[model samples]
Target: MISRFSNVNRAYVNTVGISSVFNIGDSMQITPSIKVLAIQREQEIYYDEEGKFSQFPIFEEEIPQPVFYEQLTTNFFNKNPKINVDSISVTSISSSAILQIGSTKDIVCESRTKHIRQSKN
Candidate 1:
């Protein structure tokens, strides 16, 4: 299957990979996982109290002690009379950073839901 792990951008580092696939009835369950490692060249953007923004240097190879992990799961079904996305589940994992200088952790931000319709009447 085509996945994020296979088509990662060259500008950032990631450890996401597919862990397993299990067939249950007519639906298939997919498990996509991630492990934390520092993002290369991805800046930590910050906004101060006075409404000024600043860029902080995240040193090279500094593994992120991420405070939040977000995942988006999409269910797609074709326009057949009997098929539709029934449900989805997402999970994330993380570990403690050993060489980072700040107590501050990373925020993985995203909006979590979307919907599309395919119907035959």
Candidate 2:
């Protein structure tokens, strides 16, 4: 139950609090159910003088839309059949921005998928 919502540099979280470690280009599940969002992706194709295309694959990687609470609720429901995150939002808290691990924060293990939860309200 730490307040995830703040005016500056603080994020609003729904079920879970700020991730112990956040990073750019990292996929974080702010809640138990939210999944990755697919947004408009762009790529530049190389061309020859005669408009011939190159054989190399296009490079595309964008920082996804700043995670949203509504999207998180929807994903949470789809992932969990028993508990709905929507109900939790109605009662508990909703976050605005996700806490991303920056260069200033301490970095833990790189390749670990850890899930930490709060036991009390």
**What's the lDDT of the predicted structure labeled candidate 2?**
0.28
When superposed on Cα atoms, how far off is each prediction in RMSD? Answer: 20.9, 20.4
Please write out the lDDT profile of model 1 over residues 39-72, one tens digit for every residue. Answer: 2323454334422112222222345555757886
lDDT of each candidate versus the true structure: 0.28, 0.28
Error of 2 at 74 (Å): 42
**lDDT by residue for model 2 over 1-121, one digit each (tens)?**
1112212233333453322232233242433222222222244433344222232122122324545667333222233222112211112222222334322222222111223232333
Q: Pairs clashing in candidate 1? A: none
Off by over 4 Å in 1: 1-104
